[model samples]
Target: MTWGVVAIAGVLGLATPLLVRPLLRRYGVADDPNERSSHRERTLRGGGVAPLLAIGVGYLLVLALGNTAAVGTVLLLAGAAVAAGLLGLAEDVRGLPVMVRASLQLVIGIGAAAGLCIAFGQQWWAAALGALLIAAYINIANFMDGLNGISGLHGLLSGMVYGALGAFSGSAWLTATGIVVAVAFASFLPWNLTRPGLFLGDVGSYVLGASLASLAVASAMSGISLVTALAPLAIYLADTLVTLARRAARGEPVLRPHRTHAYQRLTDTGLSHVQASLTVSVFSLGAAIVGVLIPLAGLNQWAGAAVIVAIAVVYLLLPRLRGSRLPRKPQTALVDIDRPAAIAPRVDFYPKRWIVLGASGFVGSAVADHLVAAGHDVVRLTAPRLALMPETAANPISVERALNSDDFDALVRAFEGSDVVINAAGRATPDSPADADLYGANALLPAFVARAASSAGVARAIHLSSAAVQGRRSTLDESLDTSPFSPYSHSKALGERLFLSFGSPDGETDHVVIRATSVQGPGRATTESFRHIARSFVASVAAPGNQPTVVSSIDGLVDFVTRVGGSSGPLGPIMLQPWEGHSAYDVLSAAGGSPRILPRWICTMVLVVVRGLGRVIPEVAGAGRRLELMWLGQDQRSEYTLEFPAMPNHVLVGILSNREDAS
Candidate 1:
């Protein structure tokens, strides 16, 4: 009959979720995973309704069957559990202040304890102890609900202990209540363990805590040993106290929603949610055997205490040992351009499938190479097959095929399953310098990519912009408004605006614009890379002691790419600058040359003469303009500084010098 009641309760628990799941979805009561969340996808919340309903159904059903033994106690305790569950549901809908929430919990806990004391005819001291124990259990259980399957496993394990204690002590009320609590959570476990289906939320956790605490108190008041009541909960108590102490010692905000609990740390140390949950459940089971079953089997108090100490010792060392065994990845610093509060700092990122537009270009190729070398899956989206320049990888789709199709069919086809879509394809130096080409490649391409990325459910879409967008600033800062001095700068600025204005299809997709100063590196050679190359030549030939502007190294570009690309945090727009300022003359001087510093007027004259010569030399004017900008440090220095380790001024220049020497 007792097992039949448990089965009936389990059936109700299973049925409740099927009903509640649809309601939650219809009402949009879902949980969107954030930085502190373990799951990656949004899922239904408030699955606590399952267990809460099941317990209520079981209580009424048992009473209807004329099982009147301890019926009053069962009703009273179950009512308190329902009240606690409602309070948690209220919090889920609209957050309550900590003081209000905690005060309410105290009232419910103390009220249940007092009720148990009166029913069992216990003394005032017993009432006080019950209140304290119940309150502590409620809160500890609440704190322990950080991971998936943990709360359910805890509910199952602790329920079994209380149920067995009730059976042995011959309290029908305790036995029935324990069975209801266990069976309810057992029914909910399948939904939790299989996929990102449902979360217990605050409501479910609160009810679990209240139910378990009240059961413990009721049993103890009914002549069950206090040790037996506490033993099943020993693991939870220890973990909570230890974790709380650690957080307090570190001066962390105790009330904030953070993932720092021992079990959370276990997950961080490479244990899956299932593993962490099972580990805690296993400990709770061991504790029940030593503290409850062994005592029932006539073991002495000292033996139980010794076993508990062993459990505590194992709990203390488990995370540390497991963490040590796991290989640690190098931690990367996450930086936000302006909105620090909006961004989450992280050390590691899940490897993403990335699609690089303009895979043949300098910035595109460099970023694509880095993504591949770092083990991310990469797809190179290039020009049409007939217009295709040469391919290097397994996945290559032409730009015409990716972009020119109707209804974004081809774009969606190419972007499907990509986590990040990077639009690195832009023409900084067009052959014709036509407005149509400039606007099409720089502005329109980014806008199209942003739309496609959003439509395809990509998490992040990055569009590379040039520092030239804030052209000719005396002291360039990230906050500086765009000041396009030339056609190139104007187009780049327009491109940034287009990407930024291309709002997310859903609020979850993030768009980033990277405004980078001159990037000088190998791979796909560009005017910027050649300008730096020419600087080395100028350093080797020019009269010693002359200085020119600062340029960002290939290493600097790669560093910036890694930081921005790997971040699963908030992002908008950022500007990249040189690690430190150095003159082209300084670079040449460092490269074993005594380059004479030319007067500003002389340098201007040289540019004018080079431009005149470029009219005859065809591409000389464009090449000269690029060289002049490098010579003058592009007439801008970044207002915002990247927080990466600064490379020595001589290092980049020396690298350039070595390359120059090798050639």
Candidate 2:
């Protein structure tokens, strides 16, 4: 009789998804996408109903076997599944307000918890906390459901554990019901393959969550061991709990839709929903195996739980770890400064399909240099790129019609296979720049980039803006929430907004906007790389005297077209004042500490001498001899005063004037 009932339930349960799969797909019943949704595609879902069908079938079978300890509990589960499923279904279709839906969940979750406690002889407080636990568990499962087959896969594994453990511990009816449920999920596997025929709906996730929590309590009651049953679910639990605490502290709506989940982060980086979903499924199954074998392995129940918890603890930062870090102050610094909060994918032979906006300019030059060094293939996009001009402007050009040109088509073709798009180029020209560069280069470039990135399978889109967007400031930090003022700055802000708005065709690109400050480095070849041309001063000052000038700060320096870099064209961040000779700023910066009483006259005079020679011969600029002369003894002299003012450091002055004497 039990077998007959189990067979009927499994068949009926699995068949529901098969029946509704087509409708779900046709109607586009999917998890809605927002800033928080893990998935980009609106896949067919609402598949959780099948599991309830299995539970109902299993419950009838339990009843047929006579009212045993398992029969009563199985019936309770059937009731819980019915309630949770119905609630979740409503949320899916009608999009119930969170408070209302959560209220329903709270009641159902509480009832499920209370009934389980009654069966297990735990206190009401257990039921109360258990209600929270069940809610959190379902939340994790819901949170974990970004990828395809994950919920179903884990559900199947967890169900199998319950069945085996129940049978071994003399809970045959429970074991029988669990086996039927697991088989039901397995039976429906084919329909839910690729893109998911049906989603488990809130109903399925809730039922599974309630079932797992109930199973944990029952397992402890039946002597299967608490930790053993609990370990497999620990990773999911830790993620949900920590998020709850974090969101609550931040005062964001706890039930609000957001992609803060670790699983969602994994899905963000070009991972197919199935790949990420399977990764966790594999872990759950492994956890289940370890959990089941704990007693056999001579490990304590708690020890098994510890193993699961350990993995969970480490994954607390999974989402954060998945994306590459961005720069904190993107505007001020030049170059591809990575932020600690950002995470990047490291795929071997990772396709180098990324876009650089101002590939022909200073900032673009620097970014491309490092990106190439970092092993990325570069597709340089600029307005005049189509015209076959020698180079793109430092500002936006009449790149207006370029968007409609065949060149734009080629640009799009380049991004089709790319994984990321870095918008290093922007319009820096003021609104009046005769080149028609400002509006076209600054305003339209982003849209063009966005279109290119979205069309090309690009998942990560980074927009480079100017720290100037922060308003006239010498320095700015990441936390400041200021507004823009200039046409160039306004255009930058607008570009970011546009990409964020219409950036992706499928909304896969997690649009990232980084506003940089004075960008300077060897990476950016241009007039800008010369900002670090002053870094040569540091190296010169640091170098031992009489060193080769070729080895001086000027060796292998980054390059660029001065005419382009010097223009206030559309590229947002300016080159900053190119190194004119090291200022006091450069001197102290080279000293690497608070400035002491270095002779200013000596250093200035030395720089004057070397700079004069630099104009004649690049190799002579700030040779070690000049740096040595400056460092030795440049003190203020007041010979007319009765007190003998220090003219210079005698030992160091002697070294500068007489190389043999210094030696």
Candidate 3:
């Protein structure tokens, strides 16, 4: 199809903001940045009305071209999405309660499903799952609207995916829908940026999300599992699920109001809205590309599932990858008969003068041990001892206080005379009603410490930050700018800045911020992502062929943290995977189990392309994933590799065997 649809739609996308901007003031439909909302200014709330307008206009334009049937389908779905979006619109115009909005969403979802392309004939399972996915996505999309251009950009990329995958002939309806969505997204984007006129009101987001979810369902019906079809959206999915589960467990209204999603965290981490949006877009787009190819590569369903399983594992692991999960089974004591003269071990490792923030955590403990073993005196700092350590501290110091202003003095006192400092502190809080104290301690607090370090002329600092700071749900590397999608990430950047600014000659300090993929090793892990992977890996292996909520790969990249007093090795530069690039199953395989998300053959294809990419375009990533974003009409495989670095044949066989046995 001609690019006109996307081009025109993009232009019109801006119109919504312009038109709605005036209406917002007239109707008093605007959001005030305060305890529960994000924006600082009183901006228009129903900007999503623009895409609805665009869709309507597209129909007028296309109907004259004898495309009435397609227009009817497009409008029906768009109308349903719009109806659903009204929930957000009502909330936008007048803050509605949660139960009210959600009840409306369920109604809209069911109604929209009835009017969907299933009328043309769809698999029964696809219809049901698609409806649920669509409805869920509507909220996901709406939830993503926390930052500027995020939800809009998601629409843009998903539109591109449809354009790439839907065949012009065989899937003309979808092709047309893609065109309409493209035009709508294009028109909507400008308004989101430069200046705001229209917001993709809940209506816009719902339509975008619901429609995309429907497409994913369609793909799943082609026999691809939800795990594979929805891979591109994994970042969002994983973050949303984690945030929801965390909130739900706490009895917080998970669906109500909270900017705790990973994307929200990235935005908070200090990246601009654009940076955060692009960061997420990059990975999601790449994932969508990789996901589409898995099943097409002649890898059987099981293999594809394995690859995807690996991906899900990585999503949770990358944040905890730097440290090893040295979870040793409590040293079991053997009978005295076998050990008549047990020798006492020598003093091998010393407590290094290294300080660890969030020391009580699993990875933090591992990191502390690593430094202490290097022979320097080490000090461990935890967020006040809510729960004291059971075992005696080798060199552990629990500094207790609210991470905010409360503990700054005590924290300062603890930092004195420390050589290397590693901040592994993090917290889970919604952005709106923020845990300012924790945000300060975990995110802003670092900056405060950095400022102190600057004053004292302290030299070395290594800030351990999550890959979530990169944003999106896909593969990423250093080339991409920092995109903090949530409050956590936003604060992370602030903290990192404190270190960098502290190190600057002007600021009087210098330090290095190591953005780890994820720190994994041992019990009591620092990150929920790693724990989730562990849990999911076990669950997936136990029930093979069933899709897990997440996916990544064994060949996925991981970062291991190793440092010294004034210097560190591998400091030059290396690739670190975002949430999407670190494979969970691969790491789990390090234990035992076949990955159920990504098949080995499919992964082999991607590995080949990644290697060839450096030689071809000199860009180290995404070339292959980029290819995956296009129309899935054509199915082909990349040449397979016999071997890949780190991923050995033995591990592959072991994982597969384990998977079968577990199943």
Candidate 4:
């Protein structure tokens, strides 16, 4: 009969979201994207009302059915959970001051704890401890609710574990309340995990924390061990406390909105929201199991505590471990980008099939590998005699073939049936004496590819142009007119212009020119060269060394390409590099170098002398470009209106580490 009530609550949980979401939307209860937010879109929030409503209905059913066994305890827990939800709802509707919210939460916690203590004939001090625990967890759950499915899954898993423990302990109220909490949260999962996702917001997170804390306290007071009661929430508690401690130690404001949490760091290290959230859930599940077994199997409580501690330690260390691990081999299809948000209601632009030109080259191969890993159908068209060995070659979806760059007909035939064509073919070496080869590869190939893609009915073509086309400008952006300083830059500029000029006669294929800045990654000659320069004894930076330079990771470039290529809507003809905030000194320091800081004027005088020498010496003339890059530093607009993922520091560190490993 109690199980029947749980089932009915589950049904209410599932249906309540459908009925409430429209109301939420009508009321404009949406969570907008912010710097600290995990999600991007303005999504409807306060979805926690579903589970809260379900739990309330379940408790009412309990009373209506005359299931008076431990009814007082169940009613007290329900009242507390509902009260927390109502408080959260107020926060969701009209924001509350932190102090006001905290005070109200304390009041609700004290009342719930005192009532529960009286019902169980426990001491007043026990009530005080329970109140503190309840209030602390309410904040903890709220803090951890940044990612989708995290809070919901935590509640669902924890409720199940507690329910199992209740059944074993023969606590009828605990069993019913635990099951109600479990099913209630379980019902919210679909709303969160699916398309047009809703956030739990304060209301949902508060209810979750309140209900779980109430259950844990109730169970502990009823003879369930404290260790078992806390097992399900151990990870969240550890994450919150450790993060707070670290921030406090650094003298940072603990209340500042920042993405430094363990789970957030995991996503920063390249785990998707789903992946990171599930990781936390997995650890929580493990701890919960250990917690349940201590009492059920008559195992020592201390042993269970040790097991949970181990799990928490591992969970905390995972982001660091993830960074040190070998880079993930490319998968089959381009999956979703690692934006720590749920899917927004937007046009899906993932290409069904792609043709990557010059797939043997560094940037080309990296892009090809990423595409293949993402499970997109990829065709690698390599220059004749240049063998293409993509990182994702093991995948059957990737097709490779040698193609002549000058053969227009052949290029068209190769592009047939593909939705997108990524033209990474170009000559980048500045010192090459053979200007003809540079012109042929950098200037002529793009024109040929663009026309061929259009002729073959390809949907989009992404041409990789160098930022060098803009020369050593103080401000670099896609809007800037090309100012080529050398033959190589001239050729790249011509290629970009030519590629943009040849859209399909029927307007079937769109072309996008990505002006990549100082792109560096594992196995690239440029990366190695930069590393060597950084590690040299003469490595020095202008004082303060804080000027932003244009640097894009190969991984970030691949992600940007996939996003731009897959978009079905019209995009501007030119796009700049997806900027990750790394200055010249930051790049050098990241490469394991401690560059000496020199006075800015001293660096300026050195640059003036170098420029003077450049006119007289042909070899030194090329040094002018390098000198400009070092002293003034090329500053591009770092923020993009287009929602491209920037390469996080952990990913850059991982790439550098990979390069080190290879060497």
Please give the CA lDDT of all the candidate structures. 0.69, 0.55, 0.51, 0.78
Which regions of candidate 3 deviate over 4 angstroms? 1-8, 35-38, 59-64, 67-75, 95-97, 115-125, 196-198, 218-229, 250-253, 294-302, 305-663
Q: Model 3 misses residue 201 by how many Å?
A: 3.3
Superior by lDDT: candidate 1 or candidate 2: 1
Candidate with more favorable, higher TM-score: 3 or 4: 4
Q: For residues 142-229, could you state the per-residue lDDT of candidate 2 as single tens digits?
A: 7766556777777777878878777666677558656765766665565566443556777778767766766665565446666776
Q: What tens-digit string does per-residue lDDT give for candidate 3 at 21-117?
A: 7777798776667755657676766777778667655545545555565655555556564566556667767777666776777676666555553
The CA lDDT at 25 in model 4 is: 94
TM-scores for all candidates: the values are: 0.49, 0.48, 0.46, 0.49
Predict model 2's lDDT versus the native: 0.55
Give the distance in Å from residue 267's predicted Cα in candidate 1 to where it truly belongs: 1.6
Q: Where is model 3 poorest over a 10-residue stretch in terms of lDDT?
A: 631-640
Q: Please, what are the lDDT tens digits per residue for candidate 1 over residues 1-663?
A: 367788888998788887888888887777898867777889888999888888878878777776776677877788878988898888877779877988898888778888888899999888787777766777787788877899998888888778888778777777777878888898889988877579887789888989988888888788877777778888888888876666444333344565766777788888899998999889888887787755478877777878886897697678887763322211111111223122334445564788888888777777788888888899999732211111210011233343465535576678889877777777767232323455566655665677677778887777788776665455555553776533455556656665655546345667777666665554435533444555454533222323345455655665566567667554445455544466656544443455545567777778789866644433344456555654565444443344444455655664555554221
What is the Cα-based lDDT of residue 61 in candidate 3?
53
lDDT of 2 at 3: 65
Clash statistics: count for each candidate: 14, 45, 105, 10
| Ten residues in sequence with the least summed lDDT for candidate 1 | 386-395
